[model samples]
Target: MGILDGKNILVAGVTMHTSIGYKVAELAQQEGATVIVSNFGRAMSLTGRVIKRLDPVPALIELDVTDDEHLAGLADTLREHVDHLDGVVHSIAFANPETALGGRFLQTSWPDVGQAVHVSAYSLVALAMACRPLLGRGSSIVGMTFDATVSWPFYDWMGVAKAALESANRYLARYLGPDGVRSNLISAGPIDTLAKKAIPGTEEFNRVWGERAPLGWSTTDSVPAAKGVLSLLSDYFPATTGEIIHVDGGLHATGS
Candidate 1:
């Protein structure tokens, strides 16, 4: 039997066929979850093309995480599918283009950092809470993150936001645990996603991933990270929470 048979998953941030969100939704379905995807305004058309890529098209929901209207509307939208959610995969992130792409940390303004943190880090908490009424026992909420151990070139405000994301995972786990809800983050290595456009030194991250990762690295395949996301979405991680599992081909463990 599939690990998530009859379960419903809400995957946010699918923009294109090459998107990591696309890969996660694809694998979640393969693992037997009833997947519902989410996309924003201008990106809505792109999501339709991505849905066609799925073997059996999953339902699509409109969600722009930063919009209060979208947040309030989510529960109603979810009602069209199942009454509750088994899991949520948050692949959403962003930064003011000007604040990223090698922008100096000192040069970034609070408005830009606020936006970065709101959309990327704080949304995880919002996602869990907004779905709380619908998520009963055994329901999981998983988000994506980078190492956040140290800063990377061109990462700028996004890096600071990821640190907040890491911290938020712990807080969510503690607060949500009593009710059987779980929160976790997948610290994936640098993958070639639209989000990566913010990182100024892209070539450096790619080179580091290939050299430091003991298992070797290829940014082409997001399947490994997709699997990690699915693992947390399933009952397999029953006792796991407030954790940041690395899916970076051992890059985080390498010395020197």
Candidate 2:
């Protein structure tokens, strides 16, 4: 039997087939979990088309984390598909191009910075709070993060957002722990995703990871990170919470 058999999982932020969220959903299905994807507006149609590729096509639900109406309706929308969720993956992140790239850290506007933090970092808290009613003991919440401890060339405000995400993970863990629900993040290396293409200097970071990381790196493959996410969602990491698991080909541990 697959490790996640009978589990119901809600995964968000699947924009394209190559997205890490897509890979996680695919693997979660393969491991016997019943997966439901969350997207909103234009993205819902895209996810609807993409999920057809799975053996048992999963349901798609609307969830715009920034919208209070959507957040208020999340648990109810999810209940229509499954009674409750065993796990939820927060894979959504975005920033205005101006705030994200081209060395605009000093010049980025307050609104742009707030937008970045809201979507990339605060959404995790928003998602957890929205989905908590559907989750219970043994349930896990996972989010995607980059190595936020250091700065990157063109990462700028998104880097700051990630740091906030890391901090949020800890607080979520602390508050949710009493309820037996776990919160964690997977700090993945640069992978060739549509989101990565938007960052101006991701190629350089990918190259550095390939050279400096002990396990080398694969910008084309997200399966390793996907596998790590599934492990956390499964019974394997029952006691783990508020942890940042690095699936970066050992880059985070190595010195440049």
Candidate 3:
């Protein structure tokens, strides 16, 4: 049986086939998990089309984490898919164009910065709590993150958002650990996904990533990273809460 043979996983942030969410959900199914996908405002149609690409198309539910009405109904929404959930992959992230690129820290207005942190960071905690009741022992909450150890040009507010995500993940683990709910972050390297392409200076980031990562780099295939998520979803990481798994080909450890 696959590592996740009996796991019930909820994956968020699947707006397109090119998104990391697509690969995560696809891999989860291959690894024997019953997967459910979450769609946000305006992307519901695209999410539906993407589901068909999965081996056994997973159910889709509304989860615009930024919207209270949607958040309140998320449990009921997913009830249409499965009775309970064992894992959650928080792949959701967003920042206004103004806050993401062609932007500087000083130029970012509070509303823009606020939105960045809210949807990109705070939402993880909100989702974990929202799904807590459904999660029993051995359940997990996985969120995506960037190294963000250093400031990245053109990343502006989004970088700030990632930093918050990293911190929030730890806090979630601390609180949820008592309940047997594990929380962790995957610090992925520069990927060429649509999200990365939208940011300015992506070419520069790609160059640096390729040069620094010993295993080089690739955004074309997120299957390996998807597997890492699967590992966390399984019992393999029994004591791995609040940890940051680097799926960037060891770039996070490179000094040169």
Candidate 4:
């Protein structure tokens, strides 16, 4: 039997077939869970195309993380497809090119930083709150994060944004814990996705990770990280919440 058999899940941030979010949705279904997807604006069309790739193509919901109306109406909209969610996968994050690459951390504007944090960090809270009505006992919320404990070359303000996301993950766990809702993050090693392509110096980042990580690393393979997400979303992590599980090939524990 599949680990997630009979569970209902909402997966957000799928923009391409290579997207981690897309892989989550693909695997969730393969594991016998029903999946619903969400994307926004121009990405909506892209997600629609990617949805065609899934075995039982799921429904797509509109979710512009920055839009108050969208966040406010999220649960209600999701209700149209699935009555409730047993798990929520938040594989969403973004930063303006200037805030992410170009080594402009010192000169990065507040507006850019604000945009990054809002979408990449605070959106976690927003998503949790909107999906609150659907999440209940034994429900899980899993998100993706880059290792934010240390600054990486060219990551810049986006690094700051990821740190905020890590902090937010903890807070969400505390607030949602009473209701039995669990929140966690997977700090994955660099994987080749459409989003990673936008980063300026990912090649060197990948090379360094491969060299330094004890288990080695594969930028083209997302299955291992995707499996990590599935584990958290399943009943396997019953007592775990507000935790950052690093699926970085043991890189986070390394000194060099």
Candidate 5:
């Protein structure tokens, strides 16, 4: 039997097949979870096309986390497909490449930084609360992150946003713990997905991981990170919460 058998999961922010979110949905379904995938704006079309490759195509929903209406109505929208959610994978993050990223940190406008934090960090709490009614004991809330403990070139404001994300995760665990809900994050190594392509100097990340990651890292392979997310969603990590699991091939552990 699959580890996630009988569970209902929502994987938000999926677009291309190469995306980690897509990989998570694919594996979740393969492991017996009923998966619903979501994206916003024009990317919804791409997500629609890619998810068809799954054995049982998942339902695609439009969710702009910045939209109060979208966040407020999330659970109701989800109910049309599944009675309840056993897990929620938050795979969403964004920052303006023009102003907030690529070493533009000091010059980035408040609006851009605000947008980054809103979408990348606060949305974790927003999404969790929106799905709170559907979640019960043993329900898992997992988010994706880059290791925000240290800064990286070109990561700039997005790195600050990720730091906020990491902090928000701990707070979510504190508040949601009372409800028996668990919140955690996966700090993954750089993968060459469409999202990564948008970030300037991504090649630098690949080079760093290649040289330092003791277990080695692959910019092309997303399966290892996806597997880490699944493990968190499964019953195997029942006692784990408010933690950050590094799936960066030991890169996070390396000291310079």
Candidate 6:
């Protein structure tokens, strides 16, 4: 039997086949989990088309995390597909390319910063609460993050947002722990996904990872990071919560 056999999982923020969420969804199914995928706006159509590649294509739902109505009715909507969720993969984040990222940290407006924090960080809590009714003992919540402990050349506000995400994860673990639920995040190395392309100086990240990552890093392959997410979602990490697992080829351990 697979690690996640008979589990119900919802993976949010899948749009393209190149995305980490896509890989997570694909692998989750292979590991015997019944996966439901979600996206919002125009990307929903892209997510719908891309998931068809899976054996029994997962159900795709629209979830704009920033919307109160969507968050409020999430569990009800989710009930249509599955009775309960064993895992929720929160793979959502966003920041304005022009004002909130790429060295414009000092100039970013509050609106842009708020949007970034709301989507990237706060949504983790929102998603968990929205799914709380369907979650029970042994349930897990996992989110994606870039290393937020240090600053990067062009990461700017998005870096700040990730830091918030890290902090929010801890709080979730603290509060959810009472219910036997776990919350954690995976801090991954740079991968050449569409989201990375939106950042102005993403190439610098690849160069740094290639130079410093002890195990080497690939900009194209997302499977390693995806695997990290799966591990957290599975029974393997039963007692681990409020933790940040790095899947960045050991780069986070290096000084330079």
Q: What's the TM-score of each model vs. the native?
A: 0.97, 0.98, 0.97, 0.98, 0.99, 0.99
Question: How displaced is residue 71 in candidate 1, in Å?
Answer: 1.0
Error of 4 at 16 (Å): 0.6
Candidate 2 stretches greater than 4 Å from native: none
lDDT comparison, 1 vs 3, better candidate: 1
Give candidate 3's TM-score.
Answer: 0.97
Candidate 5 local lDDT, residue 255: 93
Candidate 3 ranges beyond 4 A from true positions: none
Checking candidate 5 for backbone clashes, the offending pairs are: none
lDDT of 2: 0.92
Backbone clash pairs for candidate 4 read none
lDDT by residue for model 2 (178-246), tens: 999999999999989988898876788877997999988889999999999999999999999999999
lDDT of 1 at 213: 92
User: Each candidate: what lDDT?
Assistant: 0.87, 0.92, 0.86, 0.91, 0.93, 0.96
The better candidate by lDDT, 2 or 6, is 6
* Model 4 TM-score (2 dp): 0.98
Q: If the candidates were sorted by their lDDT against the true structure, best first, what order would they fall in?
A: 6, 5, 2, 4, 1, 3
Full-model lDDT, candidate 1? 0.87
- lDDT string for model 1 (111-218, tens) is 888988999999988877777888988999999999999878778788889999999999999999999999999998878877675467777889998878999878
Task: Note each model's CA RMSD in angstroms.
Answer: 1.1, 0.8, 1.1, 0.9, 0.7, 0.5
The residue pairs that clash in candidate 1, if any, are 154-200
How close to the true structure is residue 110 of candidate 6, measured as C-alpha lDDT? 98
State how far residue 113 of model 2 sits from its true place (Å): 0.4
Which digits, one per residue and each the tens of the lDDT, describe model 5 over residues 49-83?
Answer: 89989989999999988899998999999999999
